[model samples]
Target: MAEAELPDPPSQGIIGYLKMVGPGVILGSLAIGSGEWILFPALVVKYGPYLLWAALLSAIIQAVVAVESLKYTIYCGQPIHKAYQRLPPNPMTWAWIWTLLIIIPVVWPGWAMSSATALAALQLGRLPGPQDSYLVLAWGLFALTVGLLVIHVGRKIQRTLEIVSWPLLILLLATIIVGVAFSASPSAWATVLSGFAGFLRPRLGFPPRDQINWFIVSAAIAYIPAGFGFNLFMSSYARDKGWGMGSKIGYISGLIGGRKVELKTEEMPFNVDDPENLRRWRGWLKVARLDSYLFFSGLTMITLILTTVMTYSLLVPRGLAPTGFKVAAAQAKALSEVLGGLAWIIVLLGGFWVLFDNQWGLMDSVGRTVADNFWFASERIKRWAKNDPRRIYYLTVYLIYGVAVIIMVLSTVFKIARPYELAATGAVLGLFALMIAPILQLIVSNRILPKPLRPGIVSNIIMIIGAVFYGFLITAMCLQMFAGITI
Candidate 1:
């Protein structure tokens, strides 16, 4: 591999490590929303934590994938999408397919609409009623608007994320811990521990007749923290934050009309053969790994276990499952039930922040992914948008707003499906990216990246395992859609 320019080594020390922690925190904050607050709890309440193994397994698999994907961005200062576009045979085609798979399913308006449901439930005694129809729409619209505005108000995207994510992440985790502590019993602890131990011997056990269809539901939940497109977007966040090689490419502007910039020659890839450069690269890798486990996987596992335990202790005994529009509200009420009205305030405040952040973070990621893909796929996009990241970024954001608003309006008017159900279904669809992302990330990491910079054999093996696991779920989902097989 020819030598290219490289960025300075990541800062070494407590402050330096702290600065590198934004992306994972942002991802963790988003993960705490629908999946933790609603789906995991609802499923555990009905299924008795029997499938806790899936959550444990999924987090490990995703962490492996996340590290490998970050390698691409850290090495080349480019997101995986651009690197995936360099794949053999038909890079553009592969990029197109994955881009669509990641963006479309995720934009299903489930999170925004679900936030509205919880807000309505808070204001009224139940989910949105006929008289509260306008208020519900306002709630959903408000979330979308705030999310869009937050990103636009600032010029540096990374700074904005750091300011918002860290505080919210801490608050969200504390609430879940407190909520679970107040609600748990010895038996509930037993169920959680047993299910976690079940990780050694995973099974699809007989599908539940009365509770959630764990077979399909767990697949969706697995995609929350690090699976689905969430893992892939981490590369962008890292690159934009100027970590390692990402510093070369710089970052996109957060404002809609921020000044335009172009990549400089020094920001390009560096020669792996250079010993000093290689040592610096290794240093940055350590930083990335630390952030991955500490904030990304660590917080994710903590929140998932607590929420499951809390709900298991509270709802499983009564055979109650939170469903439909009241999903978030139900979780809050569960805590309130055990610890009284104060718990409701705690849970509700935490739940609202999480749901709102989830929607906001996702919209930013989806917009960035699409905009980045288009920027790489065609010179026409570059010319049309004048190579300005802000223009393309806002264009995609507006596009997402349109799709989300349409789904929100239809779901409100028709009442065909509940908000939480719609959100979970969208998550299920998002598993499509998980199936393909590992393969693409693996290919790019090995083929496009220099040999010494490539992932180790162990990393490669796990990527395959991750692919196969998601493939099995995707196949099962396909079979159910076509052949009516349950499990």
Candidate 2:
């Protein structure tokens, strides 16, 4: 791809605005998957919506981080990790360490396992147990295969993500909204409204030991929308979409034999010497923020609100707490109660889509991140992925699904919650990245980006808030890990 081949600037007005919104939908759809559907609601059912504050605060803070990260690709056609590789004092070390810590957990098979459990319960009465390992493994592999195939069929990763994501997003919202209307009572609606008010002032507190679980759940809430590591993937996705200077670098091709495109391992910073280029850059930046705030952050917030509220109305009242395979069946049953028996099927279908989407999004994003990071880290690593990242990408996908299948089999054999544990562990690690990513972004943006493109006071302020907010959670989580402080 040449510089002149950059995506044409949008036409003026709302139509132009709508066109700029495509990339954000991919982000939003990825954001609203298992974490919003499974983790957030699960937590809400157990502890109510007082912690809704975590989701609200995390979305805004992560939005700031996400925008800052996007600036790299928008202006320079470089993903955030490339910027991180430019960090002082052993950038390669930082790249490798954070890569393993962040990507492994997020892409782990727990999500596929969770979704399969739900599918199994919907088909049977419950998850596959000691006597049913074959069923769990088959269903788990099926879900993983479907998601992988969906992405493999399309030519461009961005287009594929958008195509798959749009229907899944629409289906989920429609099913949930209709379910809410049919089942949620007048009082249930009122409680949801009041829950928003209650979020402002946390009226309830956990006991000393339970704080560990509280922090664990809070970490998942903060990360469900945008984790520290996933933010980088968002930048990669934008780059692939030809958002700004990113257009200069072409996209990844589909799994089938298509035109093979490869990004040069070297960095190609956007030349902003001319004032006209700067003007166009600013326009692209506005488009980026619009998508980041309204679509990526905004849509995620709306979805979380509905899922949490539904859990409160249906599961909390009935004293149901979703764990392991029960998350899918229990939530589906709650929807069935409101929308009738047929609605259970809808919920199950939605759950399966969300889970499959979640797995697909994680596998693709994390795999791309690792491949990109390797490709940029050193020339030797670049050739290791065969100079064509699609190889590394598919390899990573296979490895992730393979591991997840093992987790499913183990869980079935032992009747344990291994997938959930891996997911929760990943969430905690991802949140730790969330705490550090903004601080890194703040430093990188000021150091690398030109004065005109750097973040302003308002963005910096939000980044600070994000750092402090995520920092506190990380501190508590660390203390819990080391000091054996339960809470």
Candidate 3:
């Protein structure tokens, strides 16, 4: 607390570089998995790629919100949770709403995915009929074990995330890039154009039996949550890194902190008075947002179009329904006439890579954020988990998540619920989460920000508008889901 000496911003040594890269790697992991990999594909198969725009739009909105989060962190040094507390606390009527806002949605994916994964493993070769019940038991066990490990060895948990994320991303991107290119036939191109139209020109009403239906049109709303889970998660990350806001019109962005993506809340905070450091951090901010580039944005938009085309071509019109190895088998069989199992490799690797890794990112970010939250707890408790406090806590979080996954997975065993239903519930939760993120960012950026480093006119305007747009999406989706609609 003395001017004479201050703990330096996180040491930028070899260790510092690794520490920084961790979050992005984690984010990368989560992005590919549950959201992009699993959810997007599932949506595409059912709806036939018309909602691809949803993905691009969601990513763009998320990037803007993410930058805002970084700005707050670099300036205010408060993670998103505390940042909300910085916002005026909610009235009694909204208290439970605010508390449940992040927690339920946040935990849903983990539980859902755990259940899915366990069920998946069974399909992949685990157990038999009434599969989900057995899976749920396993899911609960995994959550418990991971949680306990976190309570003991939190630091190991951190390293483990980095270990898991980077490789997953590299493998995933490589696979997808290849598969998408290879899959682009002239016929596929035609389908993409038409599907893009379908997505863009939505007919908002009831459809005939098994025609587009309410469930299908509801994609407009569902897409938001499908892509925006990390808005606030990353917001907390930015706050923790000590970022501040700015007029962002001319900032050409790129990836700065790949191997060096993070800074403890204080380390990255902006200091306008320190011109050199400010420039360095700003430069990194732009890079960290490579997905925001005009060209990249266009690519994402087109990707949406193409995905929809492919889905409708294969599914709705043809009446070809496939899942698991069956889906891959069909694709491979089609390609075998042209190039053999090469297509199979591309199908499996690319399709599965993103979803698998994305989980790592979500779990890792939350684990780290939680670790940072009460990292100062008595060493004795930490010792009980193990000597490595941070790792212990992260493992504990994963385990805490295991319970819900188990419950849902067991539904299959008990014949109480179905996979599609679980997917529907998860999709709804994810969408509502999108609606909640912007306001959280606004609070963190506005109030938590140092006055001098606050967001300027233009950026703030865009942010306010963004928040309202998502709020609208959230409201529509909630109404639809509550009313027993399914798309």
Candidate 4:
């Protein structure tokens, strides 16, 4: 691997940094998927706002995890997975482990199935029923096809996500704001505000032992901003968007317009010992931190709170809890009480986009993660693809699409599990990866980067806390699932 001289960071004030923000915006949009649109609302409707503190905790911890992971990418201009390949006794071991870890949780297609139900409800002018399984399946396939077309036509995958995400993000937030303004009562607002402090609420701090559904709760936590291995993809986006040392490396281009672009597999390390390089490194780090806090953290928290409050206000009063494929439909039905028939259109349309965007973003990340790992892990694959990462990426994308289609058919036709159920199951299964990712990030950043470029004490402590917290949750969930015990 050749070492590249560190270029001076883009000279910019706060305004310049704000204008440069793209990856976090895309990430924030991705974060708003099944968790916000489906899972969080379901949790709120069932337990009221008492569980909201978990959302708060998740956001803060995941923010630390995301920023620390980016340290490797910003310093090396490669996805963090590339750094993971440098870990331990055998590089191939982590590569194969992470590929499986990324694929298993994301292959469920829950978001697409749920989005299809929303579309089906929109077409039918009512909540979809069991009889509508085929209808929903058709819509699910349609959604996946459309998502494929959009990604294929784009010049760059990250650029496409940014362009689509910005408007979708604005629309989702605007829709939620309008719904909350018209529908949420003053008392509902108070309850939601206090729920952020739910840890302090006596006997209500955590779900009671009997009411605890470990899988669903784990899913909810996983999705507080984004869940499972998805947050780790933030480094990939930042790299593709040319943040920090990523400016020197190439990105994964799309199939049509991006056919000629080649992703550099060679590691490009900056000269961290240079004073100028260190100075530029600080500036770049600042940009990443601001982007994560403002777009990823800020947008996610705002959306989560507003959506939860609005759903709690609307559904709890009607004794409704969204579950199954009816997740979006149930919310639309509740909104109909106040917004009239248009409520169905409003709720379902917003829900579809929320979920569709999630599906689109998640598929891309999963494709990228898998392709990168395989490309790095196997010289045979590298030779087979002829060194073009895009070939592997697109192939992975289409293959995942095929698998998702199959899963959607089975789930819809045979009633294997509800959309939310599938989402929760996928999330819970990914918890081990989630638990290990931060610890790996901590090791990679501390061990590889120069002292001045290493994570500070606070970051180290926060990452440790995040790892331990997730490890504890994973243990409790395993005990409950296997030992017939609850904690």
Candidate 5:
């Protein structure tokens, strides 16, 4: 090939590095879910980031599991966007029959908007007969505004995400800054250090007064099913960039080989290819590592660390959101007692984008990919979904969201509210099972993928330990829940 024909030198250098980091970051950032960033930070403000150990431990275990899932999709030809299709379920379709439950995340906007009422409530504080009502009204208005923006300014799929992440990233940073600046105290660091200690030993539920309930933890774990989407998203982004493997993968970054010269230098988060990795690893370890530190230690670990810090810095004291707040208002009182509400506010924004968009965007894409890969569909249908795919998951997510909110509201109002039912009803269990599956897949990937692509001995140990620790923790949580101490 001519010199011009040769691929650009991957726009390497510091700026190029961030570009590579984008895709993995999208998924890795998933580690900052509503639970950790929002609820956890809220917990921290209320308790102090000292419980960061719980957040850290949870994030570390889950990140290990999440990266492995994404790795299977990226290097292996497993399109995780619709991994549910391949998971050995059959003889019956849980999705078709359980469509009601599937829609929880879809209609999530209402819940988000309801939660977002904080902006207005804080502004209007102690000003009205019913502040929460005004908050809900504000949520309705916010959703409409976001919808209009998505409809008008976001002319294309990619454009919309750009719009979303711009605010999401900005706000995510704001949380860490504001919470630390405001919430920190003489006891803060000491508490945080002690909190980190909890990372090693995860107690199932919140401290006694929080009354978090067993169902809440279940809800957090339920998203494990959603982890599959990240794998598919990162894999496609990896393929788009070209270096799905090597130091690039290890760094947990994807290289976008042919973008504009100026754009190339923006953020090359990728780890360049390395022969050394191929020499030392094989199977799942190799496949999971993709790009030296990029995919594994570096990319995944950054997310885990950020999660731990964010969790400690925010969640432990904040009280864990609506449920936590209920406990506080009924049991405690005073917002000052809750920490980092603003940090949590930012986290909620990020969570909404990461989880919702990832699901909606990838659902359509995954459905079409699977159809082409396994089924014999009409060329037109295949082309449409493949080129501009959309699927049932989006609608399901949207609708179920509406139901979940209604249920939550009713439960809260009627005093018959077993809102934990949303999670107990199933999703979290699926998420946990899914987490276990990746560790299994990692072992399998090691055996299945080419010898050169395997994970390192260290990676394998880390993953194995993750699997064991999470497994044991879940068991304890279950036992604790059953023991009736009231989480």
Candidate 6:
């Protein structure tokens, strides 16, 4: 593969830029699922709203990481994983590390199980019980199969996500907003707002050390807006959307509707010295930042706040703490108080959609990341797939879904873990990847890119702060789990 010239960016005003907001919307939808629906609410039920500040903080940090990671894609027309392979001393090592890191968290199928639980609740007219395990497992497997079919039939995998994301996100947000407006009291709203501001009227020592569950805390932080590796995957979405230099590199086409499209192995960065290209670069960067900050980060925070306030108001007063697979179910049952029987239908239905969309997005993203890394790291695989990245993509997707099925079976049949527990475990593991992502982005952005393209001092500082924040959380969790010491 030879170097290619960067194409001029599309000239877009506000409306045009809004039209190009697919990647961020998709990313935001991805975050809304397990994190907002499952973990954050679970935390609020146990710890109260005081710790909501952590959600805001995590969103801000991940937003910066999202932008920085996309820098590589904007400049080189390749995913950030490619840039990781460019790092000094054992580049292939980075590929293998990322492959494992991405696979571990995503393969657990937590979102699917959660989605299925919601469906089972909907069917049973109440929360599902131990006897309903088979029903949940059946629904989970069906959901996974539906996801696989959706991915296989689309023209482009990312485009399919973007289409599914927009409507589902709007519906989910609208449902939550309406539920919160009618269900949450003014006092509840005030409490949540204070929590967001870190005021915590009855301040409980940040997390009230005695009551803290480090695993849930770790998962909550890692998923405030989105998980660790998913931010890196944002670059791949940008590339496929033909943003900046990414316009030059072909994307991964879907198996059925997609005509043959070839992804280039080599990167093609624009010459920083060229003034015209520099202007185009800035224009593209501005668009990307808007999409990431406003759509991805902004929407995530809005969803998180709305859901937390609603859950805090409705569930807390009744002393109802949703546990096990009842996280979504409990919220629905609470909403029924104010909204009546309709609440059950609305909440459970919306919860199912939120979680299902999340599972679909996760499978697609993990498939892309794992396939891309394997192709980049292995010569034999690259040659075998050769220009048809979809071969590896579909294969990886099937393999991941197969593993997920096995995991779901074990959980459902053997009773190893519940839906929320599986999600929490995956999230805790995701912390390791979250801790490393910013550092990796900082290195690639500063070292590989041209001076004009490198991140500013403020961005660099935020990345370092994020890295340290996650690093500290991971260390605390490990100590608590292994050494029986709580932080």
Encode model 5's per-residue lDDT on 1-487: one tens digit a residue: 0111112223445555544444444444333334433333344444444444544444444445545544544443333322343344531242232222223233333223333333443444321124355454445345434433332232223333334544554565554444345544555456555656653443422455344444445454333323222333444344334433222211111112111111110112112144433332223233333333343234433433344354443334544433422321221222234543443444333334433333233332232233323222234543443432222212322344345456545544564423223223433443354345446556554764445445567657766765675565456467667775543
> What TM-score does structure 1 among the candidates reach?
0.93
| 10 residues in a row with least lDDT, candidate 6 | 197-206
Q: Report the lDDT tens digits of candidate 1 across residue range 370-405.
A: 777777776777788887766777887888888888
Work out how many backbone clashes candidate 3 has: 64
Q: Please give the CA lDDT of all the candidate structures.
A: 0.73, 0.72, 0.46, 0.81, 0.39, 0.83
In each prediction, how many residue pairs overlap at the backbone (N, C-alpha, C within less than 3 A)?
1, 4, 64, 0, 77, 0
Which pairs of residues collide in model 6?
A: none
Order the numbered candidates by lDDT, best leading: 6, 4, 1, 2, 3, 5
Stretches off by above 4 angstroms in model 1 are: 125-133, 199-219, 263-267, 324-328
Highest lDDT: which candidate?
6
The residue-level lDDT of candidate 1 at 103 comes to 73
Model 6 lDDT per residue over 1-487, tens place: 3444567665678787877668898999888888887788888888777777777878888889889878788888888898888776665787778878888988888889888988888888888889889998999998888887878766778898898889999999998888888788889889887877664344432576687878877887788788856877889999899887788888887887888787876788777777878888888888789888988989999998888888888889989887655766787777787789999988888788888888778888888887777766777887888657888888888888899999999988899988888888888888888899989888888998889998889999999998898898899899989999988
Per-prediction TM-score: 0.93, 0.90, 0.68, 0.95, 0.60, 0.96
Error of 1 at 84 (Å): 0.6
lDDT of 4 by residue, 133-238 (tens): 8998899899888887777756678888899999999999888888778778899889888888888876546678898877777787778788776778888888
Top TM-score prediction, candidate number: 6
TM-score of 4: 0.95
The candidate, 1 or 5, that scores higher on lDDT is: 1
Kindly list the per-residue Cα lDDT of model 3 for residues 302-355, writing each as its tens digit: 334433343344444446655322343344444444556566555444544544
The deviation in Å at residue 223 for candidate 2 is 3.2
lDDT of 1 at 117: 63
User: Which model, 1 or 3, shows the larger lDDT?
Assistant: 1
Residue 286's lDDT in candidate 5 = 35
